[model samples]
Target chain A: MSESNTIPKSLQEAIGTESKKLSNDIEKGAIRRFAEAIEDNNPLYVDENYAKSLGYRNVIAPPTFLRSVQTDPLPDHIKSPYSAVVDGGSVWEYFSPVCAGDIITTITTFENVFDRDGRLGNMIFLIKTTRYTNQLSELVATQTTTSITYEPKKEN
Target chain B: MNQNLYFEDIKEGMEIPTIKKNPTTQQLVKYAGASGDFYQIHYDMDYAKNNGLPGVILHGALKNAFLGQVITDWIGNSGKLKMLEVQYKGMDLPGTPVYAKGIVTDIIDENNINCDLWLETDKGDKTTVGKAIIQLPKK
Candidate 1:
């Protein structure tokens, strides 16, 4: 069966699933710090007035800022016998801008699993994708991350 | 501002001054708060281990943020950062410190100054290899 086929019939499956509704409790100061750290002075992020004038309640976080949010605690499927979690890289597809004070929920689906070879070693790749929705359940963003893990070399 | 650094000031093997940052669970939490992410692997320790991670790991974007700070600080306000790209290599766990530093690799002259940047981090069992392209101010 396909790994996506293995998403589990039950929500309680050891593999993590289920969506957590998000809140806007994130600190504006931290957002400012991140913008400064990135050297991004885009008015939407740094200037509250600018953001507000643009209809935001407060300063906006960078698109990549989504990386810092904490999700639900559960066993990840990549750890299962099928495969391991590797850092394959992530690609974020933006459908809309993320504004301050916007509560969001993310629905994550265990996408697929595969394998590959490299000069360093054998690798297992796990594909996971998440969809972010605002308070109204309106879809906001989709992020897909591919993780790769190295298995020990087999002796010939 | 500090004096402008150029290709002439650096050598291929030369290390840029090391910068240290200790990001706390609070920092990560704040990051999550701002970024609107709720991934359990970043905060729930048991969840991470159960998921096959040693513990809640640091966000890769945080590493890029650290590297961005290093370059912007070195270049000052006059220079604009044209672009930055990185491939996530590994995870960074909480409490364990992560260090980001780089070496000068190449110098490209395009009206503005640009350099090839390499970055790395060691946090307990996880070590990451990263690289970037940064534009610097011309003297």
Candidate 2:
């Protein structure tokens, strides 16, 4: 059974449902791993002393490090119908740096969904917006991520 | 290193320093672990090929980070990165060299500098395209 038909309705109904995900306390080890993964050797991301010298309280996460901190389950209604999911894009606004030991909470809400006919038959694009707040109740960052889901076109 | 890139020192059309990275298969595995996105296409070559990929591919978010580093490194200590928007346009394979490059596009309201950024593979394929805004300190 094709699942694409129901995607639009489900996504439309999910437009304003905000789900609060598990809070993550930024940790030094996690920051180090993320920096190494991206091959970024910036001392501000891994060296506490270096970060302190730069006026930061502790080692900070790379600008996009928050991408790795989400451990929450997506709201069922907004989950992609197709198995093949790819990142479409993201827009991030950084209000403050993410420092180690800073507990951050994320509130995710579905922003939009649309369909377009293409070479691949049909493509469904889902946009999810998340707001991150630090333990001090300060807005740290806001990210809008788009995910594209589609069925692969089979060669004839 | 104190880049000390004050607002007055930069001009439109100036190019930001480029940062190059070589993403290995092992690095992809580490990225999978750290990002909790254990998608087989990023770590398992066989699975990737079956899925129509050339081989273990670098994560899109990882590529985004590379562009972020380019802006942060160029802005130095006093500048604050305010916004970044990226579109993942192409896939990048592991073990390949990716270069992050940007050029200042506009100087908005004296403090905000908007730059266009992108990641290009050694073969000249653009994998990611984006824009960033930074607020630099006044000298």
Candidate 3:
């Protein structure tokens, strides 16, 4: 698709009306391995006894552990029909901890999209918002991520 | 914990200890389960290649979490992680060792000890350049 044809200028232009939901089973061992990957030995993520002492029901996932969860990409919207898409950047807000044995469901929706003219070239910003709820339906956290879409330079 | 590194203790040129993280496919799978992200690009190399990626790339959240861990571990439990922002510049492939390193670029004490952090990755080939701001313990 051509640059002018696909690029969006505002939140209404870039955000899709449809949203997708995803579910996952967060396990204790998985949480431990995640902690190990980052080399964080915090007992809250490992020792059950220590966690209980701290009033947690079970081992809690790292604050940013939501990264491990997969998200459904936004559906098509008006404007951009670009052939390619790549993650431009992301912003995160760490709200609460996720625990093992908790089933997490995340709903993702397009938050915003904008066009920017940079030194390298023109780029498209795609923002997605995600909400997490546990099996109990308690709100766990919310993350809004922005991905940049780069299109091929227009040809004469 | 050393609270001696007040806003005054840090300098723009000073460096924080770089953390070397060796992530395994098994760990990636675990991360995938917890994050609820089942994108085939993270697990299937063939699928990833078809989708224009070099290999199964590690989740962006995983990379960002590790960056936070690096700074939080250094600051300890007494400190509060105020804010962390990162731009996904490149890929962090599975089974690759990503070294998360940061340097203190700026320091300010606006009610809290705040320092600007810069994060980078080395996976044989370079991938992901990130910067973060963290509040550290005050003396």
Candidate 4:
């Protein structure tokens, strides 16, 4: 990889090895809270009876709720300036519904690290890819979060 | 949803129904608590101003959620959101009227529909731009 002045050498060096895995249990409360937070009133997310009436195993989670199951892509104790990070955006793909009572396991990997010279200034960007699998070992979803790390402004 | 949208019912360029949301600081706080993203910039005005921002800005994730609702609401419960992609191009303020708008861009397959989506402020500011692939039942 080419030398990057903006991205942390530690971050760049940690790229494939920085993967982290975690599991979260899907519950009606969290799913309902997330749906309520977004102000989404979809019965598919909150009403178990309604969900089952619609042929679902149980009340299912909204698609973007998968982000809550993610842990930091970089392993804990890795020294890096994550405080400077800004939310870039995200991309998500859903293979199946995540229902209540599902134990969702996530394996997140640092997909890439690089620098982008933009109008603001040279900045570092990191991409983290996470795959979500259920207790049934079914791949439920995959998501990638892009974060940009802007250098802290210099004080005069 | 009382009605289901079918692949055979929509055209390549037809616009899906839009969803408008007005998010307040209270809502942002709720979102922060729910999503476990407790960044002060989303709620604490002082922290936001100290960071060179005009005011507490809407979380990019919240905008994504709005866009998701726009698509999911239009596609109905039978539809599957196969893919959702978004870019945080700009910022929006809290307690403002922002609309979730989208247009069907393509019929990728007999069952898959591609659409372009965005978040627009009442002042016509486009804060986020995105795309989605929805799998609809065939008619």
Top candidate, metric TM-score: 2
Q: In candidate 1, what are the lDDT values of residues B1-139, reduced to their tens digit?
A: 3445554454556666766667677767665555655677878879888877887877676666666556655654344444444466556666666665666666556333334443444523325544445444445
Q: Candidate 1 — what's its lDDT?
A: 0.58
Sort the candidates on DockQ, descending order.
2, 4, 3, 1
In angstroms, the error of model 2 at A43 is: 1.4
Per-residue lDDT tens digits of candidate 1, residues A1-156?
Answer: 334432233422433443444443455776677675444555656788966875667776665665654454224433534333445656555455566677766666666655556754556565667777776667766667777666444569
Clash-forming residue pairs, model 4: none
Query: What's the CA error at residue A133 for candidate 4, in Å?
Result: 0.8
TM-score: the better of candidates 1 and 3: 3
| Model 3 clashing residue pairs (backbone) | A68-B35, A69-B35, A69-B36, A69-B37, A70-B36, A70-B37, A88-A148, B90-B128
Identify the runs in model 1 with alpha carbons over 4 angstroms from their true place.
A1-85, A90-115, A118-156, B1-12, B111-126
Error of 4 at B18 (Å): 0.6
Candidate 2's residue-wise lDDT over A72-145, tens digit each? Answer: 55677677666667798999999998999899998887888877667656778888888899999999999999
lDDT of 2 by residue, B19-137 (tens): 99888988888998988889888998899999888888888888888999999889888898999999998898876899999999999855578999999987888889999999998
CAPRI quality band, candidate 4: medium
Model 4, C-alpha of A45: deviation from truth (Å) = 1.0
| Model 3 Cα shift for residue B97 (angstroms) | 2.7
Better of 2 and 3 by TM-score: 2
Ranking by lDDT: 2, 4, 3, 1
